[model samples]
Each structure stands twice: as structure tokens, then as C-alpha cells.
Target: MLSAQHINKSFSGVQVLHDVHFSLLAGEVHALLGENGAGKSTLLKTLFGMYRPDSGTLSVAGTPVVLGSPKDAQAQGIAMIHQELALIPELSVAQNVLLGNEGRELLNYGRMQARVRPFLEQVGLNVHPATPVKRLTIAQQQMVEIARAVARQARIIIMDEPTSSLTTHEIGQLYRVVRDLTARGVGIIYVSHHFDEIEELADRVTVLRDGRYIGTVRQRDVTQDQLVTMMVGRELVAQTAPPERTPGAVRLDVRGLSSNVFREVSLQVRAGEVVTLAGLIGAGRTEVLRAIYGADPSTGGEVRLEGVLMSRRTPADMMGRGVGFIAEDRRHQGIVPDARVSVNMMLTSWAKGKVGVGERDMLRAVEPQIQQLGIRPANPHQIIRRLSGGNQQKVILGRWLSAGCDLLLIDEPTRGIDVASKADIYALIDDLARSGVAVLMVSSELPEVLRLSDRILVMREGRLAGELARADASEERILALATGVHTHAKDPAVA
Candidate 1:
């Protein structure tokens, strides 16, 4: 249905794509595989008319086409769902689905609901059409986006990280939707970080690295290890976290925590201890973190730091009390995407009055840490957004290090990062622990939690279900607790 030949594109002085050739046929689900910053997004944007390639020839359905704008792409029956969702917060689900194509003389609430209810049901979404998009979960919002594409009768759809925030159950639903779309001969180009999902859904896979096509392979003919090798061009190493540090007295304590999203949660982390919260999506791990950090209001709870009671627990209050948080959605909540590295690194230090520190001074301060943490390029003034996803995460870690946080709460530290960078981050966290800092981590990767945490706490239905010490924590133990599987097993330390 779509083909491109000899595509060339560039950003500023950097050439991102060169002589790239690609094609997608009707009824085929093509998997676009690459490490972050391999120009996958750029290539998708080129196909969707968001960027005009410096040089390329494009065709759809055997006709030469010049996609000048998003409308042009849509006119040709192509649609894209971005990595970051693009739903309006104030709009209802039905309105957001029908946006730009609502053809009515007057707004008909009932009519709109009737028109969209079937489509919503087709995607297995139980959400009411009149509910505001802001109130929906990330997975629900993605479903709405897919429904909108179906409403538009798009023949070719491109989805970027659609399952990043989805639970395993939601992913099964989405896979069904993809199957339904393909059964009707709609072509799909899927971009994702989860290789297992790609293996389950794709027929053919194309690999890209460093802005060039490496090769394409049939899904059935290649192993996961082979694909990783193609994408990275090197052996991927999973480094063991450093030696565990002896934990000191309790540095952070939360008792009887009650929030709208979570309730009756109690936990604590001592100095130098790394406690990981493990659970599936919607298990309320992020809500508990926010409540403890004072970013979200809790109806009933008490936070104590080293026997000192805290009267107020706002973000400012937490920061003053030496608590730092690195949120999960780094793009939306963590960093200033457009700012220079030095600027982002200096943000938490703003209260200390360093307005964009000089390159020499910033480097002088962060240079050794950057090297130790393996931050690529080691430049403090480079625009942060231009860096790869892993490097951006490292930059965020550098921020906390530069600011000297006493207790750190990190959420999904390696969600989409590369393996090498993941090792670096693990080492950085261990180094922090050695310095007498407490680390509370939240992750969806069971093996990661098992490997790095001194103890693992599993959440089920928004409550702490079980806790396992490092020596006793295993994949089976964590998974059983997370999925509510009953087994004759116990973490002796917790018992």
C-alpha cells in the first residue's frame, strides 16, 4: 500500500536518513525495529507528511504521491498515533474521536454518543463516551486514538509505543484490535520497545541503527538475540548491580497512607537500602510514589524522616526535607525537553542561583560523574532533546546527583532505555546507596526489580501484597505476588 525509495533527510547539520528504502503491502503488519534515535520516528513522520524529506520518491496504491501536510496523508488514508498521545484534556471521549470530522449543524450529545458507542465497543473499551479524556487511563486514551483512526477509515496506520503504558491485559485487547484491522486489509507499521509484543504481532521485521537500515528479516526466521545484535551491532550485556550496601536506620517511613487512587499503604526504606515496588499497570505504584513525594494529596497518612515528623508534605516540603523524585514520564514531567543539558541539570539547583551555569564550570562539576555514569558526549550545553532516550535518562539522574538528594524515588528508570545505559543507571543507583542515600524504585520489569533491589514489595489492587528480601526474591516469587498467584513460598526475612 505504501513505498518509499532513496529517502534522504537531515536535522540541522546532521543527516538522519540516507538512501533508505521501505515498503508495506496491504494486510501485512510490519515491525519497525531500532534502538532509540535510529530515525524511526523521522521515517514515520516522512511517510505521514509531517516532514518533507530532502530527497525521496513516494507512492501509495501504485500512484505517485507528494504528502505535503497531515491532511494530505489523511486524504490518502494514512494516520499516525504519536508516542505521546495527542488527546485534548477538556474534550469528551466521543468529541475527541469525532474531532475535525464532525458533520452536524448543531452539537448533538445523544447523537454523538450513539455514533461512537459502537466503535468504542468494537475496541472493547468500557469507558463512557461522555467521560472527559483527562479522566481516562493512558491505555484507554490510546484505545480512543485507535477508534478515531478506524472512524476515519484509515487504510494505513502507524502506532508508536502504543503499549508502553498498557498492562498485559490491555495489550491483549489491542492485539485483537490489530488483528481485526488486518482482517479487513488495513496495513499497520508498529514501533515499540517491547520485543515480545513485536514477536507476537509482526510477520516481518526491519532493523535500523544509527540512521541506516541494517536488514529486514522474517519474524519466524530470526531469534530475539539475533534481532538485538542487528539493532545494536554488539553483544548486549546485562550487568549485575554492585554489592549490596548495609542499610542504616529508617530514613523514610510512610504509615497508613490513603489516597484516592491508593489506600492503607505502609512502607519504609532505610539509608543505603534499595526497595523496589513491583506491580502490573493500574496496581497504583505511581500513585503511592506521588503521595509520598507530596505531589498528590492524600486523605490520611503520615511521613516521618529519621524520627522527625513532617507537618506539611508538598513537593516543596519534600524537597526541603531532602526527598527527590524522578518521575516515570520523563518527557511530560521530568525534564525541559528543549532546554540545554546544563540548564536541565541546574534546575533543582535554581534556588541556589545558578542561571545556566557555564560550560567549563558545569563540566568541571559533572564531568567525572558523567564519565562514571557513562553519559555519552559528556557535553553540558548540548540540547537535551537531541540526545537518545537513554542519555536523557542519564541526564535526569545527573540532576539528582548534582543536587545531592538524600532519599530518591525513581519510577521505571529503564522503561525504553538501551541495555548498556541500563547497566550504567544501575551502577549509578548503587553508588548513591553506598553514599548513605535511600533509594525507592518502581519498575514493571520483574527481573530488573529482582536483580537490583535489596528488597521487593509487590502491590495488588493498590495495596502492598508482599515483600521479599534480595536473597529470597526471584522471578517466580515476584510474578506470583504481582499476579496474585498462590504458592507455598515465603520471604524468610519478611516473615
Candidate 2:
């Protein structure tokens, strides 16, 4: 239903998409795979009328067409579901679904709810249509967005990172929804950084690298390793080796931690050790880490670093205690978006009365890290907002390391980043552990927990369920602990 030929797009004298061609046959789910800044979003915008390409043509149903805006594309039976959902929080599900197409212009919610109920049921969303959207979870809100697109009767739907925030069960529901849509002859363009999702849902996969089309392959014809090579154009060096540890005295010690959201939790991370907290979403992993760092006020807890007791205080106080935190939501709590990379990188150093370091020293320190992390543009003066998600994360991690932090409290260190960038972050963390920086991290991806952790602490329902050594950990053991499943076989790989 949608196809593009030789599309070329540019912004501010830089080409982002060149000689790119894509197609979405009716009743097919096409997967678009790329690392950060590979031009996947650019192609979607060009097809959705948000950008007018400098060259090439887009067609609908074999007819060439030019779209001036999203409305123009919508009128031609195309809809896009963005990663950040656009539902109005104050409105009900029915109201958000029929926002512009309220039929009689009189804003009758009862009639709207009745009209929206079928679409909700069609997408397997069982919530009442009258329910306010803000009351739902992230996964529920995403399903509501999908229902909205289905209500538009669009022949082509573009889903960008739809499963990024979803849990395993919610992702399964989304997969079922996608299958239902494809069964109805709806063409879908699925853009994501997940390889497993593509393997499960994509009928065909197209790879992009550095704004150029690499190639397309059928799902059954390509291995996961091959797909990684195509997307990055290099053999991925395995960076998952566990870090060597020469752990000394305990650097971070927490005891009887209690929050309104989390129960009593006690843990210790020693110097030169990388310890990770692994659990499913909403398991209070982020809460415990935030409490230790003083970002969240804990109802009760005793924390110490290097044998000095810590007080219930602010983030700056924690920093003064030789602790640094890398928040999960980097866009808000981490960086100054309007500032330059050099400024953001040196923010912590300046805040700590280390202003004697000149601009040359700051840039010199960041220059090697920039090269190591593969941050694009490699320009210290570039605005933080101009970098991709993965590159921005590298800068944030660089900020804390440059501050000379002794202990790091990190949450979801690589969330929403691409695979190649994930490798860079993993290696950096592994290096930190080797350099005697105690690291306590929370990650939802099991592979990460297995790859980096000297010890994996499993949290379930806000309590410590179990702990596994690096030599004994596996995906099954972690899942069993996270879900409260009893198993005599905690480490089958130990033998």
C-alpha cells in the first residue's frame, strides 16, 4: 500500500537519507532495523509528510503522491504511532480516539464511548472507553494509541519503538494485535532496536547504516549475527565478558532500606565489583537505587560509602559523599539539553569546586572518551539536543566518570539505546569496575545482567529474592527468582 523510490533527504547541508528505497506490501509487516542515527525515523517522517524529500517519489496504491502534512497523509489512509504517546491525559479513552473525528461536532462522550468500544475490543484492550487515559500504565497507553490508529481505518500504520517500554507479556499482546492487523490487510512499518522482536514479527527485514540502505532480507534467511553485521557493517566484537574483580573494602553499604514503594532491602557493593539488580518492570528496582542516591526520600534506610554513614539528603549531598547517579530518564534528570557537550560533561566537576580545570583540560579529558564511546560529530561544542539517544547517554556516563566518583548508582544504564551503543556502554562499565569504581546498577535486560555482574541480586516485590554469582547465573534462574518461582536448580551451568 506504501512504497518509496530512490528517496533522498537532507537537513542543514547534511544528508541523512540517500538513495533509500522502501516498500510495504499490503498484508505484510516490514521491519526497519538500525543503530542510533541510522535514518530510520527520517524515512518514516518523509513517508508521513512531515518532510518533503529533496529527490525521489512516494506512492500510495501504485499511484505517485506528494503529501504536504500529516493530515494529508491521514486522508490518504496512513497513520503513525510515535514512541512518545500523544494521548491527552485529561481525556477519556473514547475522547482521545475520536479526537478530530467526533462525527457530529457536539462532543457527546456517550456516543463516542460506544463508537470506540469496538476498536478497543479489536485491539484486545479491555479497559472501559470512559476510563481516563492517565490512570493506565505505559503499556496500556500504548495499546490505546494502537486502537486510535485502528479507528482511523488507515491502510498503512507506522509503529516506532512501540515495544520499547512494554514488558514481556505486554509485548506479546502487541504482537497479537499486529498479527490481527496484518490479517486484515493492513501494511505495517515496524521500527525498533530489538532483534528478538524483529525475529518474531517481521516478514521481511531492511537494514540501514549511516543513512544508507544496506540491504533487505527475508526473516527466515538471515541469522541474528548477520543482521548485526549488516546494521553496523562490522563484525561485532563480543564485549559481554564479565569484568575481572579485585574487590577490596565495601564501598556502598545499605541496610534496612524502606520506602513507601519498597520494603526493607539490604545490599552491599564492594570496590572493584560490578553488582546488578535484576527484576521485571515495576519491581521497585529504580526506587531502591534512587533512595540510596538520595534522589528519592526513603522512609527508612542506613547507607554508607567507605564506612562513613550517609544522611538523608539531596543529590548534591550524595555527590559530595563521592557518589554519582545516572538516572533512567536521562532527558530530564541527567543533562542540560540546551547546553553544549563540553559544558554538560564538566557540570559536575565545576559544581564540586574543581573549577581550576581549564577548558582545554576538560576537552582533552572528554576527547578520548568521545572516541572510545563512538559519539558522533565528536565535536565538544555540539548541543546536547542534537545527539542521538545512545550518544547522549555516553555523554551522561562521561559526566559522572569525569567527576571522579568513587561509587556509581545507575538505573537502566542502556535503556532506549541501540545495540552498538549498548556494547560501548557495557565495555565502559566493565572498565569502571576494573578501575576500582564500585558500580551498583539496575537493568531489565537479562543478558546485560549476566554479562556485567560479578553478582546478580534479584529483586521481586521490593524484596531481595536471591543472589547469583557470575559463574552460576543464567536467564532461567534470574526469571525464576524475579517471578517467585521455586527451583532447586538455581545454577545449572555451575557444573
Candidate 3:
């Protein structure tokens, strides 16, 4: 349905794509796999007409074409769904679905909803067309995006990390939608860091490494280990059980913490310990973290830092008391998109009354951390928004590391990060714990929780259902706790 040959793209004189070639056949799901800065986004943008290659030829249905904008691509039966959602929050679902294509005609709410309802149904989104988009969950919003693409009659669609924020059940729904689209002869170019998704959905997998095409292979023909080797030219060591440590005095103590989403959550993280909150989506893990950091209002609770009651639990108060928070929503809550890497990294320091530090001094101070975290482009002056998701996450971690906080509250630390970057983050967290920085984290990925946590606390229905030490923690046990299924054996650790 679409093809690009000899594609080369550069940004600010730095080449990002080199003689890259990609093709999509009708009714097939072609997956594009890569690490954070491996040119995946650039290639997708090129295909979707958000970017023009320096040297390349794009052909649609055997005819050469030049796409000057996304409109041109849409006219040529191509659409893209970005990882960060693009729908207007206040707009109705129908309005967003038929946004540009609504024509210059007079507004007709009834007609608009009627026309957009079929597309919504086609994507299995059950909400009323007139419903406000912000009221829908992330999964529903994604379906709305797909509904819009389907409404455009797009023959080719690019989905970037569509399941990054979805739960297991929601992911299954997405798979069904993809299959339905493919059955209707719609071609898809899927991008994700999750190998299991690619293995399930992709007919063929093409890999890019450091802006260069590595190779393409049939999904069933290659192991994940082989793909990892292609991605990083490495056989990464599997994460093993962390060594046992005797944690120091309690650093963060939450007693009967209650919020709108959760109730009476009590937990303690000792100095030098890594305590992970494990749960399904909407289990209030994020709210708990936010409440602890004073980002969310707590109806009741006492948060103590090293036995001192924190009567005023504001963000500045927590930061002043040697606490740092890494938010789950990196795009909105965690980063200053317009700021330079140095500025974003030094935000905490500046907030703590280091306002006299000049830009040069800030850059010099954060340079070591930037290098240590392996932030790509390696330029402190670079705008952080231009970096990949994994690199952006690294900068956020660098922010806290530079702040030299004693306690860290991290939520989904590696949510959208690639594998190599995830390992880097894991090592960094381990290092922090070893250095006596108390770590409290929330993670939905079972493997990550198992790999990193000194202790796992499972939350179900916004409450702590049980707790498991590192030795007793397993995927099955954690799920049992999370899903509220009683284990046959009476385990003392479970509460």
C-alpha cells in the first residue's frame, strides 16, 4: 500500500535516517522496532507527511507522490496515531473524530454525532458520540483516535506505542480492533518496545539501530534475544535477584493514607530500601504516589519523614525535606518541554533557592549526570522535547539525582522506555538504593517489579491487599494478590 526507498533525513545537520527503506502491504501489520533514538519516529513521521526526507522516493499504490503535509498524507489514505494523545479534551468525541473533515458547513451537532457514531462503533468504542473526550479513559481515547483514522478511510495507519498505557484487557480489545482493520484490508505500521505485542500482532518486524536499518525478519523466525542483539548489538544479561540488604531506619512512613481513589493505605520504606507498589491499572498506585508527594489531596493520613511528622505536605515542602518525585506522566507533569536539558535537570535545584546559578553554571553542574545517564545527543543545551521518550525519562531521573534527594517517589519509572534504557534505569535505581536513597515506586509490569523490588506491595481496589518479600514474590503470587484471589496455602506474608 505504501513504500519509501533510499530515505535519508537529518536534523540540524545530524543525520537521523540513512538510506532507510520501508514498505507496507495491504491487510498486513508491519512492526517497526528500535531503541529510543533509532529513527523510528522520524521514519513514521516521514511516511505520515509530518517530515520530508532529504533524499527519498515515496510511492503509494505504484504511483510516486510528494506529501507536503499531514493533509496530503490523509488524502492519500494515510493517518498516524501518536503515543501522546492529540484529542482536544473539551471537544465531544464526534467533534474530534470529524474535526478537519467536518467541512466548512454550519455546525450540526446531531448530524455530526450521527455521521461519527458508525466509526466509533467500528473501533468498539461504546461511548456516546456527544460525550466529552476527557471523560473517557485512555484506552477509550485511543479507540477514538482509531475511529478517526477509520473515518478518514485510511488504507495505511501508523500506531506508535498504542498499548503503552493500556491494561491487559484493554490491550486484548486493541488486538481485536487491529485484526478487524487488517481483515478489511487496512495496512498498519505498528511501533512498540514490547516484544510480546510485536510477536502477537506483527507479520514482519523491521529493526533500526542508531538511525540505521538493521534488518527485517518474520516474527516467528526470530527470537526476542536475536532482536535484542540486532537492536543493541548485545546479548543483555538477564536481570537477576538483587542482593539482600539490611535497610536502615524508616525514611518514609505513611499511616492510614486516604484519598479519593484509595483508602487507608499504610506503608513504610526504610532508608536504602526499594519498595514497589504493584497493581493493575486504576488500582490507585499513582494516586498513592501523588498523595505521598503532596501532588494530590489526602483526605486523611500522616506522612512522616524519618519520624518527623510532615504537617505541611506540599511539593516544595517535600523537596525541601530531601524528597523527590518522578511522575508517571512524563510529558505533562515531569518535563518542561520548551526547556533545555540543563534547565530541566536543574529545576529542583532552582526550586530550592538556587536561583542565582547562571545557565552556564547549571549546564556545568548537570553535565556529569547527563553523561552518566547516557542522554543521547550528549548536549546539555539541546531542547529536551526533541529527545526520545527513554532519553526524556533519563533526564527526569537526572533531575532528582542532581537534586541529591534522600527519598525518591517514582511512578512507572520505565513506562514507555526501551529495553536497554530500562536496564540503565534499573541499575540507576539499584545504585540509588545502595547509596541509601529510599525508593518507593509503582509499576504495572510484573517482571520489572520482580526484578527491582526489595519488597512488593500489591494493591487491589485502591487498598493494599498483601505484601511479599523479594524471596516470596512471583508473578503468580503478585497477580493473585492484585486480583483478590486467595492462595490455597495460607501464606504468613500476605495480609
Instruction: Report the number of the highest-TM-score candidate.
Output: 3
Pairs in clash, predicted candidate 1: none
Query: Candidate 2 — which residues are off by over 4 angstroms?
Result: 353-365, 488-495
Q: Per-residue lDDT of 194-221 in model 1, one digit per residue for the tens? A: 7788888998888888778888889889
- The numbered model that scores best in lDDT is 3
lDDT of 2: 0.87
User: Which prediction has more favorable TM-score, 1 or 2?
Assistant: 2
Would you estimate the TM-scores of all the predictions? 0.90, 0.93, 0.97
Spell out the clash pairs found in candidate 3: none
TM-score of decoy 3: 0.97
Residue range 1-495, candidate 3, lDDT tens digits: 899999999877778899898989999999998898888988999998999899989999999999888999999999899999989999999999998989642298888888998998899999999899999999999999999999899999999999999999999999999999999999999999999999899999999988888888988999999999999888999878678867999999999999989999999999999999998899999999999999889999899999999978999899999999999889999999998888899998888766347877786788899889999878888888878889999999998888789999999999888999899999999999999999999999999999899999999999998899999988888988899776776676544
- Order of all candidates by TM-score, from best down to worst? 3, 2, 1
Query: What stretches of model 1 exceed 4 Å from their correct place?
Result: 239-243, 353-360, 363-382, 488-495
- lDDT-sorted candidate list, best first: 3, 2, 1
| Clashing pairs for predicted structure model 2, backbone only | none
On a 0 to 1 TM-score scale, where does candidate 2 land against the true structure? 0.93
Task: Compute the lDDT of residue 108 as modeled in candidate 3.
Answer: 81
